[model samples]
Target chain A: MLLQINDVNKQYTNNKVTNTVLDHVSVSVKEGEFISILGPSGCGKSTLLSMVAGLVKPTSGTIMLDGQPIQKPGKDRGMVFQQSALFPWLNVEENVMFPFKKEMNKQEALQKAKHYLQMVQLSNYGKHYPHELSGGMQQRVAIARAFTMDPKVLLMDEPFGALDEQTRTRMHGELERIWLDTKKTVLFVTHSISESIKLSERIIVMGTRPGRIIADIPVTLPRPRRFDAPETIQLEKQINHLLKEEIDKVVKEELSYAENR
Target chain B: MQRIGKQLVFFVGLVIAWELIVRAGGWTPDVMPKPTDVWEAMKRGFSDRTLVYDLQASFTRLFIGLVISLALGTALGILLAKSKTADDTLGALILALQSVPSIVWLPLAIMWFGLNEKAVIFIVVLGGTLVMTINMRMGIKNVPPLYIRAAETMGSKGIDQFIRVILPASVPYAVTGMRLAWAFAWRALMAAEILSTGPGLGYTLKYASDFGDMSLVIAVMILIGVIGSIVDLLLFQRVERNVMKRWGLETN
Candidate 1:
């Protein structure tokens, strides 16, 4: 296993009231596999991803990366945040070059950054700042930055959640191409039903109340899956049926909570 | 270009109004000198090298005081931002000190350093330090959590994180602090020079007032205003724009 998350539990305590965000969640990721943890908005999918990234420790269980207990954020596990999280001060090339500074000199880092930028088809934006780029372009730069590290595992937390529907579709193609070309182990966290079906080799559907895995479904569809593909549509319907119950429960809870307030 | 032209128009109009008032009132040079009279006095001081000497004296003191304040203020500011103990104790003390006017330290400065250059520099440092330190602390504290998290994942830690992420992100705030510090240091310098027998614009103004040389006094006052505004326009504002542009904080 490239990464192993065993019986992970995360609880937040506020003024003696404990909120269980994750409960007994377990998953194993294989090398060079594209895995998507799909869930509703409050399903603790992101929390699980963060634990694997070593950004937050699980309350009870342990996360192992390449047979070692994951302790803290490391270069071996590259993460792409929803907001792009690009350094505003550095240009496109410099931001990608940042992670490689420890292993190489300035010239080598620049060359490697250029190589990744070419991979993402953002070679012309080397000197442009984050604010100068469009939302999709900024995310592309972020993808380039993460791919530059060539980490053992890539973690994405709804990396395309902020894009419009049109831009999001185009980015799905771009991301799939990069994932195919790199063949790095990827654990993607997202709420979109079609996105999980379109991208992942496997989908782990999670439920909300004391968030835990409810279903682990493997996507055996061939490569280059589209939104309107017959198999993609069938799988989307099946996953939506499983997630609707969890999402409806959350909606009812939120409505009652609002009414009480 | 348009902005500069508008400012020039307002400045010329004000000068014209001053000249009219002085001429209509038939004021004596001792009371209120005409615009031409003041300009003549300014030219005379420049030709005789007295004005240059006064400016050099004031600028040297300001430069020294500002350098020391920058070093001490940034160090203390980092400590205040990074350490909880320093934030709780020394931070409280600095806040209390900031509320007290910089002029309030003049007496103590004189007592500690005597009525000399050291006393003047001490007062300038006191005036500038509080503003710089406050601004620097706010700068560091306000760095976005996203930047820190991103840097951490990129394998940056400890002092490397501070240098690469925290410091660069704080550039705008640091520039703002420097601007405020410059203003404070200038005011403190004038007050200190007035008290001490320093060879600067403030001292010249005081000496001229004693002799009722209103033309020379007004000339020095105009020179002080011109120099201060020039430094603000040329140095502080330019650096601020560049930093904002590099950080992509500016739209254009």
Candidate 2:
């Protein structure tokens, strides 16, 4: 196993009221496997990804990488956020080269940054600032920046969730192609079941009200699986059925709280 | 060029109006000098090299005061912004001290430094530093939390993160602070120089007024006004606009 998350739990407390954000979340990811954590909002999907990236710590159990426990954020696990989080003051090439500030010489870092930018098909935009790029282009720059770190795993929290439908499709294909090239472990978090099915080798479906994994379904379909394919439709329906109860539970809780008030 | 022409025409009209007022109001040239009289006084002062020395003296004091003020203010601002205890304690104290005018400190400054160059420089530094500290504090406070987190995950920690990410992100606010500090320091320098025995414009203005040389006094006042606006509007404001454009923080 490349990453082992053994029975991790997270709780947040406010006004002496303890809220369980995640409960008994155990997952084991192999090297170079693309895994997606799929769930509704408030299901702590992003929290799980954050813990793996070591941005947040679990209250119990341990998240170990290669048998050693993860404690804090490190260059070995690069993160890409939904906002694209590129430094506005830096140009595209400079932003991508930020991680290698002390690690590599200037010439080598610049060469590495240029290679990744070209891989993401943004070779000509090396001099352009983040504000000059479109939303999809900015996200692509973000992905290239993460890739330039040469991290052991990429933790992406809804990296393409902010893009439009057409842009999202193009990005999904781009991400798949990049994954094929790098073959590094990618632990992606998203609320989209279709995105999970389209990209990951396996999908971990989570449910809310004390977020935990409900099912771990493996995707054995061939590459370039169409949404209209019978297996894809069947898997989507199954996951939708699983999430419908969680959504209904949230709605009922809201309704009861309103009545009590 | 068009803007300059329009302003010049308007100014010439004003000077003509001033000359008409002198003729119509029956005031002596000693009491209210005509535009031509003031112009002649400026030429005499510049040719004699008196006003030029005063200009050099005032600007030298201003430049030194500004360097110390900007460096000290930026350092203190970062300290207060990053430390919770410092922000709660010293931050409030700095804000309270900022409300006290730079002129109000002159009596204490003289008492401490005994009416010398040090006293005047102290006032100028006090004038510039407070506004800079306040603006820089706000700049650091307003940096997006997202940027910090992004840098953290990429192996940037503590001081490295601050220099690489926080400092550059807060640049627009820092530029605004510098512009404000420049204006405040200029005003404070004039106020400080008026009391001190110096060859600065303020000192010469007072000396000319006491000797009943109304022409020299008016000329000195105009020169000060022109220089102040030139530095603030031409230099500082132009740099601010370029920075805003480059950072994509332009409102329009």
Candidate 3:
């Protein structure tokens, strides 16, 4: 396993109430595998990703990357947040070069940034500020930035959730192309079932509120999967059925909790 | 071009209004000099070389005091923001001193530094430091945690993280502090000169006031206001706008 998350748990305390967000979850990822964690909102999918990225500590259990225990955020685990999160002060080139401080000199960093920017088809926008770019472009810049670090794992949390439908679809295609080109391990978290089905080699369906994995479905679809393929459609429907059942359970539980309170 | 035209029209209107008000109020030469009288007085001062000396003195004091305050205040503010011990020990004392008017410290400053350039510079520094410290602390605190984490992930830590990531990111806030500090120092220098009777614009105003030459006083006041506005608009505002534009902080 390139990555191992064993019996991981996380809790948050507000006022006096301790809310358990993740409970005894374990996941293993092979190198260059694309995996998606699918769940309802507030199912702690993003929290799980944060824990894996070492942005937050797991309440119990452990996460290891390449046999080393993860303790803090490192360049080995590059993260792309739901929001663009680009430093407003930095232009596109600078933002892309942000994580390359130790690996490259100024000239080399600039060259690498240009290379990645060209890969993202943003070579002309090297001097453009974040605000000058559209939402999709900004997110692309963010994607370029993460990839430029050459991280062992690429962790994405709803990176395209805010984009429009057309833009999202186009980005999905672009992302798939990038994934094929780079072959970096990706652990993506999303509420969109179709998005997960469309992107990942495996989809882990999670139940809401004290999130637990309800289904781990492997997608055996061929690489460079087409959006309108018959096989893709059949697999998506099967996953959708499982997801609906889990989502119904979540709604019922939420209603009961709200009524009790 | 349209905006500039509107601004020009507004400025001309303001001068016309001022001239009309002076004429309507039946102001004497000693009470409120006419705009023309003040203009003539300014021309005379320019020709005599006294105004140049006074302007140079005031500007030198302002620049020196501003530089010192900016350096010291930024250092102290960062320390306060980062260190609990420093914040707890000095926060209240700094707040108290800031609230007390800069003029109130004049006598003490004079006593400590004597009636020299140091005394005037001391007042300007005291006046400017507090606002700079407060603004800089807020700036540091407001830097996004994600950026800091991002830097750490790239092997940046401690002072390297601060200087490379944190400081450059907080340029807007620091510039704001510098602008505020300039205004405060400018006001304090005028007051310091008035009290200390130093060879500056404020002292020139005071000297004119003592001789009942209200025209010269009015001319000095106009000069001070013009210079202050020019510094803010042309220098500080230009730099701030350029930085913000490069940073994408401005919307349009």
Candidate 4:
């Protein structure tokens, strides 16, 4: 296994109230595998991804990469947030070249950044600042920046969540093509079941209220899973069946809490 | 271009109004020098090179003073922002000092450096430093936590993160700080020069008043105002607009 998250849990305390965000979630990933943590909001899916990125710490258990314990954030794992999070001060080329500062000289960094920019089909926009680009373009630059470092695991937290439907679908195709080209391990987090189905080789379905993993279903279908395909619909139904109860529980909890107030 | 044209028309209108008022009101040159009289005094001052030397002297002091203030203020600001202990102890002190006018420092400055160029420069530095420090502190404090976390995940930590991510992100605030500092320091420099009898714009204004050269006095005052606004418009505003545009903080 390239990454192992075994019996990991996270809890937060507020005003003497202890809330468990993740409970005994265990996952193992082989190298070059595409996996998605699929859940409704409040399922701690994002938190789990943060932990893997080492931006968050687990309350219990351990996460290891290639048998080394994960500690602080390292260059070995690159992350992409739902927001593009491109540094506004840096243009696209400089943003991608940011990580290469210590490893190489300016010339080498430029060449490498150029390669990644080309990979994302943004060769012409390298001189443009983040604010000048559209939302989707900014996200693409972010993706390219992440890949420039060539991290062992690429963690994306709904990298396409902010885009409109058309852009999101287009990103799905672009991302799938990039994944195939790079063959890098990916751990994606999303609430969109169709997105997960289209992108991941496996989907880890999670439940709310303590945020425990409910199932890890393998996607055995061939490459390029169509959104309207019968098999894709069947899988969506299965996952939705698992998640409907969890989402309903959340709604009922919020409704009763609001009524009490 | 449009803005410049509007400004030109307004300036020409104001000058004409001033010249007409001076003529029609029959105000003596002592009370209000004619615009042409002030212009002649300016030409004479420039031809004699006294104003040129004063200009050089004043700018030199401002340059030196600003360098020291910017360096010290930036360092102090970083210390205050980054360390809880420094902020707790020194934050209130800075706030108090900022409120106390830089002119008030003249007496204490005279005591420290005597009636010398050092005293005027000291006052200028004081005028600039406190505001710059406060602004830099605000800039560092308000950097989006998201940027820091993002950089941290990318393994840019410690000093590297501070310089590359934090510093560049706060540039808009820094530019604003610089503009305010320049305005304050310019005023402080003039006040100090007037009091201490240095070879600067303030000193020339005082000299002209003593000699009853009302035309030259008005000329110096106009020069002061024009030069101050020109720096603000050309240097500070240009830099600020560019930074704000790049940072997407543009107001218009």
Candidate 5:
């Protein structure tokens, strides 16, 4: 396994009430595999991804990458957030080169930034400020910034959740192309079942209120799956059905807890 | 061109109103000088080189004091932001000092440094440092955590991360603080010079007031206002606009 999350647990305590966010969760990701974690809101899907990215630590388990236990965030794992999160003070090229501090000379960093900007089809926008760009373009710049670091694993948390349906669909296609071209392992978190089914080779469904993986389904759709394809529509419906059942269970449990309180 | 035209019209209207007020109020020449009288005094002061010397003296002290305050205040701000212990120990002291008027320290400064440039510089530093420190601290604190996280994931750590990521990102705040500090320092220096009787525009104005030469005093006041606006518009404002434009932080 390129990455292994073993018996991970996380808890948050406020005053005297202890809320367990993740419980006895384990997952293994193979090299170059695209995996999606699908769940309802507050299901701790983001928490799990954060642990694997080393942004947060699991309370009682080890996350190992390449046989080494992860302790902190490093250059080996790239992360993309729902918001663009580009530094407003920096132009497109400078924002992309922000992570290239190890380079001895600024020229080298600029050259590297140019290369990545080209890869993202933003070469003409090197001097453009973040506010000048559209939402999709800003997110593209963010994606280019993450990939500039050349990390082995890419962790995305609802990276397209903020966009409208039309933009989101277009971004889904763009992301697929990038994934195929890069062949980097990705662990994506989202609430959209169709998004997960559309992007991932394997989908991990999570249940809420002490979140845990309830279903781990492998997808066998052919390469370059079209959004309007009959097979894609059928698979999306199947995933939607499974998600509805999990969501219903979560809602019922939430109502019972509220009544008890 | 249009903006300049508008500004010119406003200025001409202001001068006309002031001239009319002095004429209509029946005020003695000792109390309020006519606009023409003040202009004549300004030309005379300029020709004698007294105005130039006083202006230069004040400008030099203002620049030096502001520079020192900016450097020290930014360092202190960063330290306070990075360490809870520093904030706990120094935060209250900073607030207390800032609340005190800069003029209140003039007598003590004069006593300590004598009636010299050092006294004025002392006042400038005290006035500038408080605002600089507070503004910079807020700026550093306001930096988004996600950007720091992103930098960390890119293998940036320690001082390297601070310089490359934190410092550059906080430029807008620091620049704004510096601008405010300059204004404070300017006003404080004038007040200090007025009391301390230095070779400055403030001293010159005081001398004119003592002689009941209202025209010279009025000229000096106008000169001070013009110089202040010039420094703000030509120097700080230009830099601020350029930086904010490049940073995508400009509202207009």
Candidate 6:
């Protein structure tokens, strides 16, 4: 295992009110495996991903990367946020080169930035600022910046959640190509069952109410899974059925609370 | 370009109206000098080196006062932003002091520094530091937490985070603060120069008014306005526009 998250639990406390966000969740990821933690909203899926990134602390258990305990955020794990958190002050090339500060000279960093920007097909936008780019282009610059750091793992939290349907579908293909080329370990979190099925080798289905893993289904089908493929359709339907129950529970809880109020 | 053209037309119209009014009203030079009379006075003062001396003197005091306030106020602002204890104890007191006008500090300034350049500089610094501190606090507070988290994952930590992430993100706010401070310090310098005997535009205005030299007084006032506008256009506004454009803060 390249990364191990064993019996991890997380609780958040505010004003003497304690909420258990995750409960006894355990997961193991291999060096080059692509996994998706698929669930509905409020299932603590994002929280779990944040914990692995070392941005949040788990209440119990441990998360180890490369046999070392994850204590704080480092260059080892890179993250792609849902909203493309590119630094607005830096242009595309400068933003990609930012993490290379003090690690190499300016000329070498520029060269490396050029390489990654080319990888993302954004070499023409080296001098353009973030505001000048479209949403998809900005996200591309963010991906280039993250890959330029050459982290051990890439954690994406619904990286295409904000895009329209057509752009989302196109980005899925682009992301798959990038993953294939890099062959890096990835832990993706998303609410879209079809997206998870198309992208991940294994999908961890989670349930709400003190969130925990309910199923771990493997997609044994070959790469470049087509939307019309029988295996892809079957897995999507199965995961949708598993998740519908959890989503209904949430809806009912909210409805009852609203009625009482 | 359109804005400049309109401004030029309005300015020339105003000057022509002033000249016509002074001539038609039959007002003596002591009451209100004609626009051309004031322009001639300006040329004469510049030739005699009196206007240059006063401008240099006033600008030196303004520059020194600005540097001092910028350093002290920025440090104090960072302290207030970063520390809970300091903000709780001293923040309210600082706000109270700032609420009182900078002119109100004149009596105390005179008592402390006693009718010297120090007195004028002291008041100018007082006028600026409070506004700078307030703006710095707002700037630092407004820096998004997302930027910090992103920088941390890039291997920046502790002081490196503060210097690189926090500081650059707060610059837009700081620039706004500096613009407001410049306006306040300019007014405070004038008030101080008028009260204390000094070789500045304010002092020249006072001396000319006492002698009923209205043309000289009007010329000095116009010079003050011109210099202030030039600094704002060339220095403050240009920097602010560049920063805002780069940061994507500007809308259309």
* Candidate 6 error regions (>4 Å): none
Model 6 lDDT per residue over A54-167, tens place: 899999999999999999998899988887878887788999998887889999999999998998889999999898998888888888988988999998989999988988
Please give the distance, in angstroms, between residue B237's alpha carbon in candidate 4 and its true position after superposition.
0.9
DockQ of each: 0.64, 0.65, 0.46, 0.73, 0.57, 0.62
lDDT, each prediction: 0.89, 0.92, 0.88, 0.92, 0.88, 0.90
* Model 1 alpha-carbon drift over 4 Å, by segment: A255-261
Share of true Cα-Cα contacts across chains kept by each model? 0.63, 0.74, 0.46, 0.78, 0.72, 0.61
lDDT of 5 by residue, B127-217 (tens): 9998899888888888878878877777887888888778887888888998899899889989988887658999999999989999999
List model 1 lDDT by residue over A4-92, tens digit each.
89999999999999999999999999999999999988789998988877778889999988999999999998889999989888889
TM-score (second chain) of model 5: 0.95
Q: CA lDDT of B141 in candidate 2?
A: 92
lDDT (0-100) at residue B205 of candidate 6?
91
RMSD of each: 1.8, 2.3, 2.1, 1.8, 2.1, 2.1
For B1-252, candidate 2 gives per-residue lDDT tens digits of 999999999999999999999989988767999888899999999999999999999999999999989998898888888889998999999999988889889999999999888899999999999889988988999999989889989999888998999999899999999999999999999998888868899999889888888988899999989999999899999999978877778868
Candidate 1, DockQ to 2 decimals? 0.64
Report the TM-score of the second chain of model 3 against its true counterpart. Answer: 0.94
Clashing pairs in 4: none
Between prediction 1 and prediction 3, which has the larger DockQ? 1
Model 4 TM-score? 0.96
* Candidate 2 residue pairs in clash (backbone atoms < 3 Å): none
Tens-place lDDT digits, model 3, residues B1-252: 999999999988987888899999999889988888888899999999889999999999999999999998899889888888888888778888989879788888879989889999999999899999988888888888877766665656778788888888878888989998999999999999998966899999999999999999999998999999999999889988887786667776
Residue-level lDDT of model 6, residues B110-180, one tens digit each, is 89988889989999999899899988988988898888878887888889889878888999989988988
Enumerate residue pairs that collide in model 3.
Answer: none
**lDDT for model 5, on a 0 to 1 scale?**
0.88
lDDT (10s digit) by residue, model 5, range A135-220: 88888898899898888899998999998899898888888989999898999999997899789999998887788888898988
**Cα misplacement distance, residue A63 of candidate 5 (Å):** 0.9
Q: What is residue A139's positional error in candidate 3, in angstroms?
A: 2.0
- Candidate 5 chain A: minimum summed lDDT over ten consecutive residues — where? A96-105
By summed lDDT, which 10 consecutive residues of candidate 6 chain B come out lowest? B189-198
